[model samples]
Target: VGAGGETAHLAYNSGASTQHSPLEDENDYEESDAGSAIGQLVNGTNVLAIHGLNAGATSSDFHIEPQLIITTRTGGGGQTGYFATATPGAPNGRPETLRLPQTVTFSRSPGPFTGSFQLSITGAAAGQQIRYVMASPGGPFNADVPAPTLTSTLYTGPVTVNSSRLIRAAVFNPSNGQGGEPSTAQYLLLETGSGNNTSSFTSPLPIAVIDQHGGGGYGPGEPYKTSFLHFFNRGPGDIARLNAIPDVFTRISHKVRGSSSAHFPKRAYGMKTRNDQGENKKFELGGLAKANNWVWYNPWKYDDAYVRNAFMFQLSRDMGHWASRNQPAEMFLNVNGGKLDSNDYWGIYVLTEKIESGKDRLDIESIGSSDIAGDNLTGGYILKIDRADEDETAWQTPTAQAGSEDRIVVVEPEQEDEKPEQIAYIKNYIAGFETAVLADRAGNWATRNYQKYIDVPSWIDVHMLNSFALNPDSFRLSSYFHKDRNQKLKAGPIWDFDRGLNADVDSGAQYDPRQWNGTHFDMSWWKQVWRDPEFIQGWVDRWWELRGGALSDANLNQIITTMGD
Candidate 1:
């Protein structure tokens, strides 16, 4: 096929059959086919299509290029000429080409330094000039935007950089007023001979630099403040790449978040990525799933190892269940909204995915306001058993015993988004499950079997993980349950285990591994299921299966070693 939709046919035989063929003598073949005569040229848009039949085998390679030849008939002879480059199966080319200005380059790469140094900028062509801007770390400059309007200084000679700051530079054409994209580099100054003081920011993990634009310190309640977030890390196996450029930078609404951990010195934060207009924007940060909502988990003082929560989540995912994905990161929080320095370093934190209803998260169906009946009303709900917050809306199971104040709170379908019928459906579903559990314990397994209402494997896995970790808060606080449309209730994607693994130093009883951890707190559904012999056997069988595999001594040691390194 020619570039202008002209077609021709060339005969060849593929080496597929063992039968004798006319072209069998030749091992390599190349043939030229002349396209059909060209028609009068037109000025408007045109398209061409190329078609072929089994061009080659799966392991073979094939490519084709088509060209259009124009002929001018003179008085005596015809003159053949080639036009512009052939664009087979593509649109015609424009008369002129557009080019961007050259990018600006820095003499020194971003990194930590001990003293002031002379920095030079280059990479601008003769017709282009270099413009630059300097600001404190996590300042107002953003290099990702094109043709940003800023108070920039013209580059003439080397400049002295004495402190930690960010530098952004770009090339611009003076005649056309066109500017190329900008380049950014960060410089961090450190004290010489300092050990522990400087080592905090030089971590092997990724660094999260947050700037609140000189806002007040974050509070533990409503009204999240607008902030800027920048994440830096070179990638896997690149240990301590403190000079690496940021892999992610975006606007976020940041606020202090936690139930009991909110009072800690190093507070955890809940953030949602947003755009310049303050609308929700999803980002794939730290290699986790893309979601707007995220959490920066602050390990409690008892968890000196700082791997309790991460380990638990990893183990849960290894057991074929979905859990909140997280990555270890060091944070530099500029709440006062000035230059980021050693004092702004907030130490280690886990950048975690928030539990919600999404394909990458819980992988459940979403229920809309109109879906208040039939199979739609039966599912895609996330419920928690944590302490109720003021102004929170939740419902209590009808089968609750006297003095039992455990109210199930809906985590998804925000209270305002949930309909009355949908709430009633999930509420009654839990009540029925509770009633069946009590009835099944009384030898009514034939009909009122509790297993029929819940996913047995998921329940067993959740039970074994919490029990093995000796999490005192299991089955009560921060406990989660989720159900999908037309699917039975399932437990898990466990959360908030900083006090787990015998790390609760304040209480001796809770720290003891031998004691049943769930018993330390008020019993809920698991309490009733323990009386069922079937459930007991299932739990015991699952324990042995995991002990021989994922929970084996050698496997556990390997996992711990890998995480520590």
Candidate 2:
């Protein structure tokens, strides 16, 4: 629902267009009289949501080709272009609406409001048309209002909206538009902190203020205490005071995240938010869906080149592995409603998905008390090789038990009463695998190769990932390995890459590109595996394959450049 509508007559181009326009052709092509008809849509401001409907009769015909175009008002000259397109949803249980990227924020005009926004569509067939809806400042969709025109409005100086509004556009066939069928609505807010001083409260980053009500700062060994987390989404427009504060703070468990970096000035955090009944539940932060837990990563030691951790994870996911999905944000801290008027500027931080067992994450069977055998007892364990804190159980490897310096820690199923048996099973299994690996007899080694216990390719990829960046801490420290009762021991959901890319240490001759840090203490198992010719050939093959693909120089440079910007 909107006040007006302006049709941004779009041309269906055969290929990519240089300018940022709603009229720009989309990738979804319909074979037409002229080869293919590419449909596209662009938001004038904050694009809340998009749903594509099929023009054919059957409901199965629903497919919307969607896109986003963000324009930054550059002085008085005009707007600069930045656009992101939507990829197809997952094959199973797909989402109805395409989720747009979170970091994309509009610029604020020098006025009483934020920038004006519009919606446009292209590739409209006779039966197929798009409906655009808008919600008033901090309000729901006004069904009474007509679909607004998405005209390209140029202002005298800059364009702005007087209030925060939610705008959603839906494309559907004429027949499906009957009975006012519920359409997916996208919520867009006009944030007003765009031109403010770059500080704690006014900075353009999303603000997460935790008022622990006089509780001391989160640190290792700290218990999950009561705290109120007030999150503020800072776009270019002023923040809308819309929701009730009491209804906002979900009960959450909080603690300092990293072991080695826990002593650092700017600390990272781990959070677990619970439901109203104090049971485990899922929530969203910064566009992430169904996330009950999150990790706030601090990149202070990187000296502003904070992209290493995020980029490393991106590489992992790109290389067809599951890694934490991260979004960059400026963080602020305000404890117990302190003397500070607003949140204190922490620095640039990464709001990341926590590695855990869940449907949206590593789908694994949970451990049970009664089940001592079968797949139930054999699976769903998350183990790590990391620093052991007091009161936490740490299992020494066979090597460590035999006077070598290797240790494995149980990360999940951490309860004292529930984890002992499960930990024993995995630790023993690994011990046996190591025995097979370290045996002097070649026949014993052949029968008990490490490949029998673990996912060899996963380990190989982990090795490549760490080696490419010369990550010294690779498998030795902050290294995670998990097994789903029936599944083989997998090497990751890799965590803690901030120390890689030469960020934590000096850029000297020690970080020689010609030589790799594969000889680290953690690689004792890997060193044994190297003795196997098959393992060596597979390792070499996987390394070069990734180097030519996700880990290539050009691919890496592109990622680095994007993060630097």
What's the TM-score of each model vs. the native? 0.65, 0.59
Query: Residue by residue across 181-229, what tens digits does model 1's lDDT show?
Result: 6676656565443542443345667788776645556877655777677
Q: TM-score for model 2?
A: 0.59
lDDT on C-alpha atoms for all candidate structures: 0.71, 0.57
| Residue-wise C-alpha lDDT for candidate 2, range 325-417, written one tens digit per residue | 776665545343223232345667788898888777767776666656766878788877777766567777746622245467776676564
Best by TM-score: 1
Best by lDDT: 1
- Model 1 / residue 82 / CA error / Å: 44
